[model samples]
Target: MPERTHVPVAIIGAGQAGLSVSWYLGRHGIEHLVIEAETPVHAWTDTRWDNFTLVTPNWHCRLPGYSYAGDDPDGFMKRDEVVEWLNGWLDTFNPPLRTHTRVTRLRQGADGGFELTLVSADAEQLLTADDVVIATGGYPLPVIPTFARTLDPAVRQLHSEEYKNADQLPDGAVMVVGTGQSGAQIAEDLHLAGRTVHLAMGKAPRVARFYRGRDCMTWLADMGVYDVGVQEYPGGQAAREKTNHYVTGRDGGRDIDLREFAAQGMHLYGLLEDGRDSRLQFAPTLRESLDSADATYNSICADIDRHIEREGIEAPPATRYEPVWEPDDEPTALDLAAAGVTSIVWAIGYRPDYRWIEASVFDGGGRPMQTRGVTALPGLAFIGLPWMYTWGSGRFHGIDRDAAHIAASIIDRVARGSAGSVVTDGATLATTP
Candidate 1:
């Protein structure tokens, strides 16, 4: 067995969340090691399409001490620019990072720490830490329905991650499933490339790229919508379970209106109900789906309108969106071969996986039970999850608060032992919390 290494803190990911925690801990003279299964590029982000740009504006690209200072706060960062931003943050702190190493298992140690089984190319080693921050993010597993296996062998299927550009796909009509952020955007990407794109709509809502005078994101932020906490979310689980509102940042950012695409001849269908024998079945809810999405779009515009009126701000008149195209009849099925759809892009979202961490911190649904990043387990926390506390928990704009909370929790423990009290901006963490 290789020698066991120990540290005051061990971060289980090298992504922004991990790096943020590392920076905070280091600032206070805390000894920690940031470990990762990959290298300079994160596994999840490395799979983005070549033309992908952030849906949120560059101004929201705030990670710990490294906030965006570029000229284009309103513009979104391209794929390479995003990568550089992360790398730039990494370089800024220069944490004691170990890349190309995966932690196979995490168990509670008998001595009240964490036992991590580290595996790399050369050898398997053991490490221990008093506090462990699981910054691997919430979406750890890509989800493809099992029915995908039953599709025609002639049809090629690619996950959104594997998609680079329209040219990479087989030459033929393309079917894009799951009208979430990835699905809507990918479908647009294909349509723009002159590909005959067919989309399967899901319940995911839509938001306009711009409202009256500014990006809808800016309007929402100013109105304090993104600051809404998970528990305080008015939609509750119904909204939390839904994918984010679909919009795009391509070409200086614009709303992704599937209706507009349909008006332009892109085939639209309801959710993909099943697939087999070279054919696919869809729910006859395409019309309803489109209407619901439009309702959401108008709802957001109304919210912004109310905000402007309440603040008495002299802005342009608000605009309400009406459906540009409505499905006459909800398409119920598609003959993949007949439609000449040689490829299918599965853009469904991911499911979280935390089986590696042997802790009883999850609820019945396997969702972590915690306030912010702090859990019932001492010195154990989860970071970079969607709505971990607020809507921006997973995004760079609000990650610093969560990371600072975890770092503060760890620091309190180091200063006052297991019985220490760590109080953050709004909550108390650590033992006896």
Candidate 2:
């Protein structure tokens, strides 16, 4: 038997998504408790590398009750600055938060409420709540391919989440797989640190940091790209699978083109196909991959240019990005021992984890089957999932909207007695009027 506590609402996670919803719940005078496994914003403070900075500009960081008021609105915030900002925001709101408490399990209680099993260093406790908001974030685990196990055990391997700085890795050439934002940035970091970096390219798009004197994010926001909903956008399903464009917050802000990396003497390869012992095989689509990335980047820039002209927006003079097709004559296959590659970093994005959730709220693919944060189950909701509602739903700029929507649903369920099945419109999970 464990200690039992009852609350009207239970919100899991204390990141931006959790805090944003907490702010709204507090404003509504709703009784809720936020449970966090570690300090608030643990992703920024603990998981991120020391040199990590936000991919989006500072002005894009908009929470429910707080907004960035710093001088450099157009600049990107580093890991520490982001942590400090989250801490300040948490302190200002002072929501009911239980730190160091991890929710190990969540199931339906005997009384039709949610029963959460919370574990801490001191003791385990059971909590019952009328409503539960799962804001535990979208990226819970790093995705590594099965072929990684085939690599030589002598070579040190680390996921992007585990990597901190170049000092932590062994002395030798490094091969970084996956050309998403993390892969691109980490390769650049290693290259600048005097390490021979070999980057495996993927299908991630590329975008210039600043275009037409405005940050790329600013232009996207102005063009309502962020507001595009999942169902509303064409090929939304495929779009959701695509990784964010390759850009860096480092060195002020600039485009991190793969061609530029090639120019910087970094070895570029197509996707890692198979690995056995010290030998590795790569796809022979290096040229095709580079061309595809450049085309995607140029298309976005062209859209921005057309938008500026159509709206008669007074922006700085723009320059078109010309692709520099420089094909390296390196072999598609490489022996790690011969190349002196001592370490490998897999910056291949993340996947959602729902093992602790005992309820049947997830689809077959382990993704929560919620419509815009509202689920078919009454008193149950979700926030901070990618493409939850809009293109930016998972980002700081978009979390507030999803949070507010979920908060409203939770409030309505609580007010309606928190019982019976929820009526959803199939596409939009809004309560019947």
Q: Return the top candidate by TM-score.
A: 1
Q: How many clashes show up per model? A: 0, 0
lDDT by residue (tens digit), candidate 2, 254-281: 8887787788788889878889899889
**Deviation of model 2 at 26, angstroms:** 1.2
| Candidate 2 stretches greater than 4 Å from native | 316-318, 417-433
Q: Which candidate leads in lDDT? A: 1
Candidate 1 Cα lDDT to native:
0.86
Off by over 4 Å in 1: 41-45, 237-239, 417-433
TM-score of each: 0.95, 0.93
For candidate 2, give the lDDT of residue 228: 88
**Root-mean-square deviation (CA) per prediction:** 2.9, 3.7
